[model samples]
Target: MGTIVKQNKQLYKAISENKRFSLAIFICFMAILKIQYSNVESTEYLGIADTKEININSSHSVKIRNIHVIPGQTVEEDELLMELERPDLDLRIYELESQLNELKAENSFNSEMNKELKSVKVSNNENMDSPLQIKINSMTKQLIILKRKKADLFVFSKRAGVIGSINVKVGEDASPFTPLITMHDSAPSMIKGFIHESIYNKTYKGQKVVVTSISDPNKIMDAVVASVGNRIVEYPVRLRKSEASVTYGREVVIFVSKDNPFLIGEKVQIKSFEKPNEIMTAHAQAVPVRKIEDVIDLEIGVDIENTKVEPSGLVYIKDLNQTVMISDDTGRKDRPYIYTVNNSGLIDKEIEIEGVKAISDMEAISMDENGIIYIASSMSEKKNGKVSDKRKKLLMIERNDFNFKAIGEVNFYDALNKVAKSNKSEEWAQVLLAKGNKKIRINIEGILVKENTMYFGLRSGSKLTKDQFVLLKINDIKSVFAKNAIDADQISIQANVAFPIDSDFKNEGVSDIALINGELYVLTVNNTGKEGGRVLKTVLADPSNHMTELKRFKGLKPEGITYDTSASKFLISFDQGDKKSKLLLVDKF
Candidate 1:
C-alpha cells in the first residue's frame, strides 16, 4: 500500500514540472518572433534617386516629319524638338478652308444683292443673323479648330531637360498610346522612397536623412524630407525584400542639392533619423504670423498722361520728398515719362526719358545712393506674341538738380545673350525669346541697385518647376552700361540664383520686389484673374531658404512696392482697371 501511494505522487510531480517547462519555452518563442518582426521593420528603405520624367506624346495618330534632337541632347524649354504631321488631319483642314472661302464669297454676293432691294436695309444686312451668316460663323469655328489641331503636331519641349530616348523613327506611324520622346529633368534634386507603416509615425517632413548608395556605400549624402504621402501605398517590387511578398507604406520625397554626386536611376538606401517631434516643432516655428489689414487707398494721379496711370514701378526720392513712378508701355501708344508724386498723392514733376524713339515696357525702377536712376523693361515678348525691339532696353538716368536725364541705354537682349552663354545657361536666353506662352516667359518685374551691383528679379517662376523663382545679378553696373554704346562683353553676369517660391499662393508670380534693411520682400499677383496678391519675405544670400508670406490681399492687384525709410513703412501701388492707379501704405510689413 505504501509503494503505490509513493508512485502516484512521483507521477503527479513529474507532469507538473513538464507543464511549467513548456510554458517557459512558449514565452521565449514569442519574444524571439517579436524581435524578428521589429528587425524587418527597419529604419532603412530602398530609394530611387532619379530626375523626374516628362513623356511627350501625340493626341492622335501621326507620322513624324522630322526629328531635330538626338538622344542625350540637352534642350531648352519651349525649344522645337520634333515635327509631326497627320495626313488625315491635313486633308480635313484643307476641306474646311475651302468651305470657308466659298461661304465668304457667297455671303458677300448676298449682301450686295440685299443692298439693291428696297425692302432689305443695308444696316440690316450687317446686323441680321441670317441663315447664311450662321453657316459662315459655324464654318469659321470649325476651320479654327482644325488649324489649331494641325499646329499641335509641331512638338516643343515643355521643360528644360535632356533627351532620354526617341521611341519612334522619323517616318514611323504612332498613336496616342505611343510615347514619341522621353525627357528627364537636367537636375536630380529629389529622391523617391517608401517607409513601412510600423515606423511611419517616427518619420516626418523636414527630417534629416542619410542616403547611401547600395553598390557603393562610401558614396553617401545628407538630404531633407520635402514631403510625405497622406495615405499608404503599395511598395514597389524593387523596394520589397521578397519579390513574392506584398507590403505597403507611405511615400516620401527627399530633396538634395542640385549638384549631388549621384547618377539618375541609381538605387540607394535611406535611413531616417528619429526626430519627429523636434522636426515638427521647428517647421511650425518657421512660419511667420501676421494679420491682413485694410489697404488705405491714396488717390494718386498723373494728369500729363490722360490715360490711366497704370503704374508698374515705384521708387522713393528723398531729395525731392516725393515718389517716382513709372508706367509699363503695354499699350505701345503712351508717352514714356517718370512722374514724381508728393506725399499728398499729387504729381509734382514729369521727367521724360530722352533719346528713345518710343516708350518701352518700363517694368521696374531703382535709384542708387548717388541719385542715379535705372529703369528696366520687361525684356520679354510683347502681349501680342510678337518680338519688339523697343521692349529690350535698360535705361540709365542721372538726376541733375530737379531734372532726370537719360545717360545711356543698355541693349538687354545683347547683354543677356552674352551673360547666358558665358554661364552655360543658353536655355535662359532661349526661354526669354520664346513667345508662345506667358507662363514661361522671362520678365524682369523688380530692379534693385545696391553697392554698384544690380539685382533683377524675375516675374515668372522657374521654367523647370513652379516651386522656385530666379534672380540675376550684374556686378559693377557702371562697367556694363557705357556712356553711349554699350558692348555685350562689358556686362558682367555675377550669379543666377534660384530662390524657393512661396507655395501658399498658388499660380502667383512676382509682381514687384523691394529691399528694406537687407531683407527682401516680394509682391506676387495671381495670374488666374483673381485680382489678389501676397507679400512674401526672403533672403537673397540664402537661396535655399523658403519664402514666408507676410500678408495676403484680396480684391486688389498690387503691381509695385517701395519701402519708405523715413515713414518706416512700405508703399504699394495698385492697378485700378478703369480708374487711375493708387498707392497704399502698409504700416506693418
Candidate 2:
C-alpha cells in the first residue's frame, strides 16, 4: 500500500512539470505574435521619402551684382534671386531711346516738308518718300528689345522652395544657358512603397501608417497614404532588403511627416490596417503627420480621339500643374505650333512659332525651371561628300499671359557634335554614312534636361549597326550654354546596354530618357523588328548595373518619354511612322 502511494506521488509530480512546460510555450507563442504579426504593426510596405530637385538656370550673360538668398534659405515665388550690374545694358537702352527721339523729331520735320511739297505736288506719294518714318519704326523696335534685355538682368525664383545649391556668387558673370542653382520644393518629402498582394487590401489612400527606421528603431514617424496603385508591379530591389529571389507586389505612395527626421533613400518599415483614416494620431502626439495638400488632379492619359502629335514630347509645369506638348510636325504649308492642354486632353490654346525655329524633324523637347521650353532641331545633313551644319540647335519659347512666344534661341549644334565626337561616336558615324551611296541622315530621337545636364539619344547608330546599337551622349548644359561649344572635358557617353531582364527581350536602342528624383528611366524600341517598345529603369546611384526593364509597353512605336508627377504616370508619344501619331500612358511607371 505504501509503494502504491509513492507511485501516485511520482505521477502527480510528472503531471505538474508537464503543465509548467505547456504554460511557458504558450507565453512564448503569444510574445512572437505581438512582435511579428501585430495588428498594430506590419512590415509589408517599406520605403523612404525623397525631395525633388528644381534646377534654376541663368538666361543671359550678365555680371551679377547681389545675391539675395543664401544656400539652405527658403524663397517665395517670383522673389528676386540675384541682381545684375548692367551699365552697358542701360547705355544701350538709352542710346536706342535717343535714336528713337531723334527719328521722331526728323519725322515731324519731314511731315511738314511733305505737306508743303504735296501742296505744290512735289512729293505727292508718302510711300516713296518715307525713309525717315522707316528709320523711326526701326528705332522703336530696337528700344523694345533693349528694354526686354534689361528685364532679363533681374533674375527671380520660379517657385517657392528651399535653395539646395548655389553655383554662382555675387560679382560673377552668369549666363542664361547654364544652371545657376537648384532648389528643393517647399513640400515635404515623399515615400513610394510597395505592399505584398496578400495585405494590399489593408493599404489605401488616406490610411494612417507608422514609419519606423529599420536602421534606428527609436526613429519613429508617421505618414498618410497619398496613392495606392491599381496594378501589381515588380518590387524595386532598392525599396527593401529581401532574400526572396522573385518579388512582385502592389505599390503605395505616402507623404511622410514634414518634420520627420528620416534621410533620403534610407529604408524604413510601414505598418497599416484596414481603417487607415481612423488610425490618425491623437492630439498629444509629437511630430503629428501633416495633412496632405490636395494635389490638383490633372486628368492625364485619358486620350482624346483626334489629338495626334508626331515626333512628340511633353513636359509638366509643376508650379501651375499644367502640361505643354510641342509638335515637330513639318507641314508642307505652315509652321509647327505648341499645344497647351488641360487635364482632360482638351486643347486649350495654340501658340504658333516662326517657321525657321520650328524646323522640320524637330524631334526632342525639354523645359527649364524658368518655364523656358527647349526644342531640338536636327538640321545636320549628309551631303554629296561632307556633313552640312553637322550640328543641332535649340528653339526656345516661354509662356505669355494667354499664349507663348519665341523668346530667344542659342546655338547648340557645335556643342552637341563636339560632345558626340569626344565620346568616340564620330568615326563609327562616318562608317554608317559610307555604307550606302544614298545620304543617311543622323537624327536625335529624344532629349532630356536633368538639373545641370542634358541627355541626347541618337536614333541612328554607327558601324552599320543602325538601330541595333545606340549612341548616347550627355552635355553639361551650363558649359554648353556658357560657351557655344560643349566642354570637351564635360562630355560622357552612357554605356550601351541591351536590357535582358525579360526572357523575350530584344536589342532595341534607347529612344528617350527621363530622370525622376535622380533615377533615370529610358524608353527603348525595336521599331524595325518584332520588339515594339519597352521602358526600363536604372538607379542613377548604381549606374554600372544593367538597366532593369520596368514594363513592356505595347504602345505604338513610343518615341519620346516624360514623367508627370501630379498624375504619377509616365507619358509617351508614338512616332506612328507615317501613320497618325498617338499618346500612350504607362500607369505602372
Candidate 3:
C-alpha cells in the first residue's frame, strides 16, 4: 500500500506541472496578440504639426489722404483711406479750356456776318470759319476748370479697413502715385498661405482647414479654402510681411469663420483636409496587346459568312468588359491555356491555344469577347519566333496578278569610272553618276530603246513618250530590261520633232518622271549628290512645245513613283539615308 501511494503522488504532481505550463503559454500568446492589435490601430490615424505666427503688417503700399479719422480710431466700410494728389493734371486742363474759349469767340463773329451768302458760298464759309460761333464759351471754360480742381482734392480709402499708419502730413506734398499711409483690417480675418504644385492637385477649393494661432497657442480657428490662385508664383512671399527666406511654395487664401477672431499678421498653423485620389479599375480582359511598330494589326476573329477566321492580326472591339479566352502559355509546355469570358458571363479556363499572334517583334496578343484580339504596344521584350510566325500567317492578302523582279546591280564606283572614260568632262560625268548612284533602284519600264534613241512611257499603255530624249553614251546605259510588256504595247515613233528646252533644264536634265496635274513632271536633282535630292516639274502637253521647268523642292528624292487614284496624289519615296525610307505626299502636283 505504501508503494502504491507513492506512485499515485508522483502521477498527480506530473499532471499538475503540465497544467501550469499550458496556462503560462496561453497568457504569453494573448499578450503578443494584444501588441499586434495596438500596432494596427495606430496606423489608422495620422497627424502632422507645423510652426506658424501672426502677421500684423503686409507688404502692399497704399495712398492715404482724408484726415477725418485719427490713428487707433475704428472705421466703417467704404470710409476714406486716403486721397491721391494730381496738381500737374489740373493745371494742364485749365490751360486747354482757356484756349478753347478764345477760338469760340472768333467763330461767333464770322457766323453773324455771313447771312447774304449763296448755297455754295455759305457751305464754303461754314467750313472755313465755324469755330467762333459759340455764346456760352466763357461759362463752359469756367466749369471745366472747376471740375479739374475738384479731382485734385478727391479722397480714396485703401481697401475697406482700419488706418494703420499715417505717412502723409496735412501740408506735405504728395505725388499722384506715391503711398501716403498703411491701412489694415483685423476683423476675424483669414490666414492666407500657399501650397506647391506637387500638392496642389491633392487639395480643392472649399476644403475644411484647421488654423492654429502662433501668438495664442490655445486659439484655434475653423476655416475653409476661400480661393485658389489662377497662376503659379515663385516662392519667397513678396506680398506677405514675413522675413523668412525660403523659396518655392504656393499661395492660398483661407477665409476664417466669424466665430474665430484671429488678429491680422498673426501666423497660424493650417492643416488642410484633402480627399484621396481616385483610382480606376477595369477587367483584366480590357487590356490590349499592341506591337511596337504597328498596334493596328492585332489578330481578331471575324465572322465571314457564318465562318470565323483571323484577319491581319487586327481586331475591332465592339464592347469592353467581355473577353474571349485564347490559349497561351508564353511558350511554356505546361498545358498552354487561356481563360475566356463568353457572352453568357461564364468564365472558361484551360482552353486550348494555337499561338499568341503579335503585331510586331515587340508586342503580344490579347483577346476580348467575340474572339477579337488586340495588339499590346508596350511589351517588356521582343516576342519570340512563335508569335511572329502566327502573326505572319494571319495577315490578309489581296488577290492580284502583279509580278516584280530584280534585274541587275550597279556598283556606284565602277559606273562612275566608266562614265569618266567616255566623257571628256570628268567633273560633269562624276556629278551626274554620283547623283544617280544615291538612288536605291531606278526602274524604267515601258521604255523603248531603238538605235540610239530611247522613249519613256508615262503610263503602262500610253503610246506617246516625252518629246525629248537625252543623248546617252554606251557607258550611260545601266542594265536595260522590259517588264509587264505585251506585243501590242511596243513604242514605234514615226517622225522626229524639235525638243523644246525650258528654263529648268539649264542645270540638270530630268532624273525621274511622274504624271501630275494631267501633265508629266520631271524630277531634277541638285548638282551635289547629297542625301536629300531636289525635284523639278515639267509640263508635257504637246510634248514638243510645252516643256517648261516649274519649281524645285529640297529634301525630296523621287523613288518608286505611284499615282494614288483614290487620294489623287503622287506617293514619292524619299531615301532617308540608312536603308530606311519615307513617303512624301504631293497633292498639288
Candidate 4:
C-alpha cells in the first residue's frame, strides 16, 4: 500500500515539470511575436532629403573689394555677403559713352552741313547719308549695355543662409564659371521627403514624424513637418518605387534637431507617428549592399596629352594573353583605334580600325571564335535630347595578317526601329526611344554574341514592362552581312529577358554585360555622387526571372567588364572623368 502511494506522488511531480516547460515555450513564442510587431510599427517610407547648397556666383568678371561674411557665418537675404569692384569695367563704360557723344556730335554737324547744301541747291547726298549717324546709334546701344555692369560691383546675398566657403579674397578676380562663395541654409537640418498626392491631405504643417536613416535604422529622431509644397511634383528616379513608371508627390520638409547626425545627400525615411502604414512606400524595402569581398586597383600606364584614355569596352584575347579595349572619345586627328593592354595595364599596341572615321560613345566590344569583332554604340539620347548619328552605329570587323578591316556596319537605331515596327510593337518602342512620362530612353551599354544569337543590355529598363530590366535579343544577327540577306528580315527581334531589380538612379545604368560558361552577368554603375556598382548574375533560362547579386563596388565608374580565363576572374575597366582610366581585378565572386 505504501509503494502504490509513492508511485502516484512521482507521477504528479513529472506532470508539474512538463507543465512548466510548456509554459516557458509559450512565453518565448509570445515574446518573438511582440518583437516582430514592434519592428513593423516602426517601419517608415523612404525618401532623400539634404541641406541645399547655394552657390554665390559672379555675374561677370570682377575684382573682389571685400568679403563681409566669413565661413560658417549666418546672414539674411539681401544682406551684403561680399563687395566687388572692377576699374577696368568702369573705364570701358566711360570710353563707350565718350565715343557715343562724339559720334552724336559728328552726326549733328553732318546734318547741318547737308541742310546748308540743300538750301543752296547744291548736291548734298553724301552728307545726308553719311555713316556717322549709323555709328552714333550703334555706340548708344553699346554704352547702355556697358553701364549695366555697374550693378554687379555690389554683390548681395541671394538667400538667408550660412556661408559655406569664401573662394575669393580682396583684389582677386572672380569669373562667372567659379562661385565666389558657397552657402547653405541656417535653419535646423531638415529632410525633404516626397509624399504621394493621395496622402497630401493626411500630411500638414506641424505633423509629428519619426525620422530614421535609411542606411542605419538604429539612428532615429523625432521631428515635425515644417512646410508642405503647394503643388505636386514628380518623384526622383532613385526614390520612385517603379522607375519605369511616373509618380507624383508633394514635397514635405521635416525639421529635425540641429544636432542630428545625418550627412548631406544621404537618403532617409520619414514616418508619421500616427497611421504609419497608410502612405505608399516610395523606395525599395531593401537597402543597397556592397558584396565585393575585395577590390584590386590598377592604373593605366599610357597617357594621352597628359590625360589617360577613357576606356569604354573590354575583351580578352586568349592567344595574345592581353586584353583589347576601346575608347569612347577620339580626336579628329586620328581614326578610332582598339588598344591592346598587357596584364600590367600598359598599352602595348594600337590597331586602327580601317574604314571607320570616328566612334562616339563606343560602349561594348565582343569577339567571336572565328576572330570576328563587334563594337556597339550607346544609341541613347544626349543630355540635350538629340541622338547622335555617330553613336547609333554597330560595326563588324575581321582580322587578317594582323590588319583589321571592316566587314559590315549598320545604323542600329534604324535597325531597331524597323524590327519594332515589323513586330507590331512600335508603340512600346517609341516610349523606350523617347523621353517623357513612363518612358526610359534607350541606352544600350552591353552586347554579347553567342553562336547565332546576340544580346544587348539596356542601362535603363525597357518600356515593354514596368518593373523588369530588359535585354534586347536578336537571332541570326550576323546573317544580315550575307550577300542575299541585304533586303531580308534577318534581324527580327527574337526575345527580351528580364532582370529582377529596376532600381535606376540618375546617370545610373548598366556598364557592361558578359556571357561566361552559358551564364549571363550584368554590371550596373552609377556615375553620380552616390552609390557605386552592383554585379548581378542569372541564367537565360530563368523563366521566373531570378537574379542573384554577386558583387558590389564603390569609387569606380566601371564602364567595361570581361572574364579572363588565365586569371580565372573578372576584370572591370573604369572611366574616371578627367583622370586616367583604371582596371580593377575582382576576386572570384
**Residues 410-506 of candidate 3: C-alpha lDDT, one tens digit per residue:** 2322232343435524423332332343311111211222232233321111112243333222211223212111121122322123234444333
TM-score (all chains, Cα) for each model: 0.45, 0.43, 0.29, 0.45
**How does candidate 2 score on lDDT?**
0.61
Per-prediction RMSD in angstroms?
23.5, 19.2, 31.3, 22.2
Runs of candidate 1 with Cα error greater than 4 angstroms are 1-302, 329-334, 418-441, 461-464, 483-504
lDDT of 3 at 142: 69
After the best TM-score superposition of candidate 4, give how far the Cα of residue 438 lies from its true spot, in angstroms: 16
lDDT to native, each model = 0.70, 0.61, 0.37, 0.67
Give a tens-digit lDDT track for model 2, residues 1-589: 9999999999999999999999999999999977753434334567765666767765556776887889989887679988776777788888878878887877777667757775555453564357776777767878887787687677787556789898888788876666777888554466778887777777766566777778987777655566689998888777645756557778887765345667767687887644323343423132332222211212212112123445456676776566666665644422556655443333344455632433555667777666666777654454663343413456666765445666555466554544454444344334333244233345566676666566666655434343343434545565554456655556555544445545444556666666666787777777454537777777553444766667675535666667678877666665655565555555664
Which residue pairs clash within candidate 1? none
- By lDDT, the best candidate is 1
Clashing pairs in 4: none
Q: Name the lDDT value of residue 413 in candidate 4.
A: 71
Each prediction's total of clashing residue pairs, residues at least 3 apart in sequence or on different chains, is 0, 5, 33, 0
- Between prediction 2 and prediction 4, the one with superior TM-score is 4
lDDT, candidate 4, 1-589, per-residue tens: 9999999999999999999999999999999978745534422456665665767776567788888989988887679877787787888988888777787787777667757675565345655455775576677777766766676567787446789899888888877668888988654356888888777776676455667788987766655566689999998888887889888988887655445767666788887634344322223242222123334333332222112467888888776667888887754433467787644454545577876766677888888767788998888878896667788778889876557778878777766655554444443455454433333357778888888667777765345443345566666777655422322244333235444454543355567888777787777776344547777787765523567778666766778888778867687787777766677666567
